[model samples]
Each structure stands twice: as C-alpha cells, then as structure tokens.
Target: MELGACPKSMRYGPCGGVRTGGGCEVVDEPCPFVGRPLVEWAGTELAPRAIELPRFLVDHRPTGDDRVDRQVLDDYAASGVAVLLGDHLDDPPAVDRVAAAERTVDAGVPTIATITGRDRSTDERAEMIDGLLAAGVAAVLCVTGDHPSARFTAHPDVTFVSEGTLLAGEVRSRGGRVAVAESPAAEPTRQRAARLVEKQRAGADIAVLNHSGPVADVIAFAEQASALGCRLPMYAPVPVMTDLASMAALEQFPGLTIADDAVNAMHTSSDPFSTGLDLAVAMAGELLGSGSIAGVNLSGVATSGGAVERGRVMRRVVDAVTA
Candidate 1:
C-alpha cells in the first residue's frame, strides 16, 4: 500500500510494526513527529502520542442488542475509524451491544469500550470488560461517568473512577489494551501530574485527555506524563455535537467548564452544531500540529450519514502535520 507522499520510514502499520518479512517494519505508524516542532516541546522530555482517531460512532443504539446500526458500524470501518462504545452498564443490553457492533462493523481497526464507575458494580464492570475482551473489544476507556448511578441522577464531587492502576492491571492480565482519561483543566497542574502518574502506575496503555486547552498547556501535560515514564499513547476527545446538546453537556455538567471555555475561546457562529464542529476541527488541527498529541477521540457529537465526519477532518490534520 503506497502511503502517498508520506515517507515509507515514517509510515506506520498495524501492531506498531513487526518483524514480519523484514527485521522490523512499522505496521502502524500512528503519526509523524520526527523533524517536527516536537523536539522543541519541553526540551524533548515527553512522550509523543500516536495519531489516533477514537470516535463515538454508535451511542445508545436502539434494539437493546449489542448490535450497532449496521450502517454506522460500516462507515466507521470504511473510513479507518475506531468506535468507542457507549456508557451503559447493569443492563446486559448495553454490554452485549458492544460485541454486536464490533461484529456488525467488522472494520478490522481497533475498537474501545467505555467503562464508567456509575454504571456497574466493581465486579460487574470487570465482567463487562471481560465480555468486551471476549468479543474482541481489546481497548477500554475508564471514566468517572456522567452520573452517580447508572440512572444519571446524581453528580458526585469527584468522578475519576477505575482506580487507573487496578483497571490497567485487569486489562493487562487479560492481554488487552487499557486507556484512562486526563484533563489539564481538571485540577492544578501539580495534581493532574500526580493523577497521571497514578494512572500510569495502574497499567494504563494510553491516556485520553478530556479537555483541549492552549498548546503550551497541552505540551506541558504531555511532558509531565513523559517525566513519569509513561510512554503510553495519548489522545484528545473533541466534541462534535449540535450546539444545543454540546452547550447542554458543557453547561449541565459540573466539570464541563472547560468545554464552555473552549466554546468561548473560539470565534465562530453562535450555532452550537456548527460551532462545535468548527472548533473541534480547529482544536484537532492544533493537536495534530503539536507533534506531541498521539491521536484524537470524537465524542459528544452526532454522526452524519452514519459516518464520523471528524475522521475526515483528522486526515486533513494528519496530512498537514506530516507534510
């Protein structure tokens, strides 16, 4: 497969390159950072994250089965996109949907399932993860979730659940990839640094940042993670929802102040949907250009024609960065 203008050496393949026919070929070169401004970032003391597109393709699908909308799943596969299944626990329906969607999409790319503390008991969450693994859901993202219980009624003060270390151990024991969430805006830089360390210690395979801030802040957080010996890939989730839903998610949630800042920081139309997508795309451009961000995840956004439009935007960012 010709990688267009991208250099063969920088081209990544699946499985982070292997010694298949040659000694070591990049099976999946997430993105290019070498010769980029990454070196100047914090004096080169940070982990360069892979260029990933972790998208929410089928959120709260109908039919209560594990099956996602076939068209939705297919679009993800066709576009080289990965789906992060929704946040439903306790209801076997939600858990089953992950597997069904994976099978339905058959995209052959990596897929992740989200595990939230509010959704299931600790044991139940573990079982749900196990089911995801059995169904080929190797990657898992652990979050505090939106509510105290699966009912979405309560809002706890602190929601950073999954005890990063324990969850990573669980996934690793099962030989699966595990990811955790991070927010530069969640706490003081020092505290965020400590939490990142804790997550790394928990055997997290990657870190998915919740909020997007200045390039300096982004680089600082990435640097801090590296200082702690966390080479795990890092990602940023860009919300692409209708303006109203995006605004609601931002305004309603106590921790969504960052999203509000993101909205305020941008100079776009007042319309939420257009504003969200435009801002998401712009932030994505910055992330890709940073050379420190590994990849991006698309969330809080609705799909268009069964496809995650952000993936296409990401491709443009990747091309620009690599070029």
Candidate 2:
C-alpha cells in the first residue's frame, strides 16, 4: 500500500485504531498498512532510557474546572499512584495541559502528560512537550491521536506533521521521558509487536498496551514484543467501569475491547457498580500475576459529576493489587 493512501500519513503504518476486520478507523476501506510488510525503524541509536514508572498507573482527565480537577488530583496523590493525563474525546473543553500538569505536580502526584499529533503542527507539539516537562511531568506519551470526528469540524483540513514514532524521538531529544502505545488486538495482530519494536527503536522509553480482548491477549502480545527485541517496560490497560454510564464512555473508545464475560457481568448484574469494581480488581490481578507486563493501567472514564466515585473505585483496585 502507498504511504499516501493512509489517512494519518503515518510512517509507522497501521495505528492501534484499525478495525477488527482490518478497516481503517477513519474511512471504510482496509487499512493501507494491513497485509503490508512491517515498517522497520530507520534510525540507528535508541533513546536513552528514562526513569521506570510506578506499578499502578491510572488514567486521568482534567475537566477544565479547577475544583473538580483538583479533587481528582488530590485523590490520586493520596492513593500513591501515577496519573496519566490526556485528552478524552468527550472532554467538555480543552484544558491547559501544562497548567494541569503543574497542579498535579504541586499536589505531589507523579504525572505523565500526553502530546498528540492531531490538529497540532510539529512546532506546536514540541512546545507542548517542553512545557509539560517544564511543569515537572514525569514523562510524555506521544501518540498519533484518533482522527477528528464531526465535532472537530473547525479543523477539517488539519495536517498531521508527526506520528508517534517521530514524536517519540522529539521527546527524547529534549531529554524528556517518552511513552508510546500499541494495540495488540488491532488489525495486523501478528505485526503489532513488531510495530512496537520499531517505536522502541525510535526512542520510546515505555510501551502502554491498549485495551485488548483479555489478559491472555495482553500476555501473548508482551511475549511477542519481547521476542522481537522490545525491551521497554510495558503497562497493560484494565478497564474500570463501575456503572453503565462509565461503561458506555469506555465503549466509545476506538479500538478498545473489553472481555465479553466482564462486559456481560457489568450489563447483567443487579448492581453494576460493585460488579464492575470486582471485575476490575480480578482483571488487574490476573495481568500483574502473569509476570509478562511491568504494570497495569486503570483505564476508563466517568460520567459528568462521577469522577470522584470512579477514582475511588480505581483506588480500591490498586489496594487490592498491592495487598
């Protein structure tokens, strides 16, 4: 497939959002990178390794409301887990990421900020990374974000100047820690591990695996990546949905697949809140006990006004895993 055929124009080929049947997430065609040879990293030297992340990493989104966002940060600080801050597709408005990171750092929480190559030029992304690091974030997650939907019609003609691989190098060049993502369940599953190897060569210090099908899938992906010479510390995502609203929000995430049994448990149980929390703890324990992954990321979202409750659920999972 031609590079020009890809909507994201990614030098790294297929991203994590490729549909189950090998279709592009942005268009109704097969992914250009599908059935193509794995793209090898052209660079010679790898980025210097950064500091190792904590055992428990939780996803967080600042709602652009100071009071609500501060309460979330304080919860994470007290829970003793690192917070990975990024843009949620359904966020109210774009928060000042640098300011959020500063607040998180001030609250004594380890912070990892995400920089996406979506609607932002290369120079603009560079500025974001510098600002995040300056605000004392522990690392930067470089990603080729999901293509903008109709809600983002304002920038209909936005250009993607850098994909995750290029942005990983940018983060390392500035002496910032770099984390990259891979989808083990996306199309070209056999090549997903190789793709992560290429990202590692491009200077990624860590790999955060997307929500694949099950814990077994994550373990298999980790094994393949390790065999293909990927040595970065890897974190697997565990969905944390305590209610239908949270579950619905997570289901909207592109390319993420929660296990069928877990989903059914949440949908059919009389009390979804308790059922969801229990399922999360079980899944996290299984992933960590597999010994294939370095850690587990509590990955999900909350309804409006449900952030604190969701954080409490995540904290319970952390405690169970540590206990």
Highest lDDT: give the candidate number. 2
RMSD of 2: 2.0
Model 1 regions lying over 4 Å from their true place: 1-68, 88-101, 104-109, 118-123, 144-146, 149-162, 257-262, 265-273, 302-323
Worst 10 residues of 2 by lDDT: 149-158
Worst 10 residues of 1 by lDDT: 11-20
- What overall lDDT, based on C-alpha atoms, would model 1 receive against the true structure? 0.50
What does the lDDT read for residue 148 in candidate 2? 65
What tens-digit string does per-residue lDDT give for candidate 2 at 89-124? 455665787888898889999988888777777678
lDDT of 2 at 78: 85
Positional deviation of residue 94's Cα in model 2 after best superposition, in angstroms: 5.1
